[model samples]
Target: DKYTGQPLHNAVVWLDLRTTELAKELAKEGGQDRFRHVTGLPISTYFSAVKLLWLMRNDPAVAGAIREGRAMFGTIDTWLLWKMSGGHSAGGVHATDVTNASRTMLMDLKSCEWHEQTCKELGIPPEILPEIRSCSEVFG
Candidate 1:
């Protein structure tokens, strides 16, 4: 979290299986097409959104931080940017490049924007996600 400069939960790796059942449940709701139309990806635990949702449901510290507005979710690129830029001092830039953002299963494949409806369905707070930036742009 930005407030504490400490991670709310242990870093959930890409292969983590904690979100497997959640992914299956999400898939049952509308299958991969539900997400593929906008995100060009399937509803799977391999993505960031599902992992974050797992934290939201299973980790009290993470959930509380998110509810209290201290959480700042991002992929590895964003974390590097935030820390390299300023990181809780001066001015940390919470942002990620298009490639990284797109893989989160949250960004719209066409508009390159966060898909709000998908976020709501997964109980993900929009604010937790970082600003999406072009890969070639100056991040800091």
Candidate 2:
């Protein structure tokens, strides 16, 4: 969730390709194996982190919101859980299952926590990340 504890709007859709350039840059910096060992993910626009980075760089609204402590991000599941659990208006659960978080290229494949180095490298604040959870447990 955001530092303000609010849910931000217009989550970067996972399929958006706006992050292609940034993805290429990341790949060049570390090759495919850099984060692959920890996240099992190559630097690609397909991941949530890449998309988030793109939004932060290209969309002023998103960037401003984030800097203002008014942003958050997640996969479709995270958004769904937030809404279903009552959202910020209530106290929606800001969480995601490991399987989903793993797909985001943010979670550490080993410990299932937000990878600090990766987040710093990508300039994505760890606060915007959702809580990691097991797939079998109730999220909210």
Candidate that scores best on lDDT: 1
**Alpha-carbon RMSD, candidate 1:** 0.9
- lDDT string, candidate 2, 1-140, tens digits: 44444544465666778788888888888795578888998888888888888888888877898788777778889889987898867878889999999988888988989999989988999997899999989887
Residue-by-residue lDDT tens digits, candidate 1, 35-76: 888899998889999999888888999889988999999988
TM-score versus the correct structure, for each prediction: 0.96, 0.89
The TM-score measured for candidate 2 stands at: 0.89
Candidate 2 global lDDT: 0.82
**Regions more than 4 Å wrong, model 1:** none
| Residue 35 lDDT in candidate 1 | 86
RMSD (Cα, Å) for all candidates, in order, is 0.9, 2.4
Q: What Cα-based lDDT does every candidate model obtain?
A: 0.88, 0.82
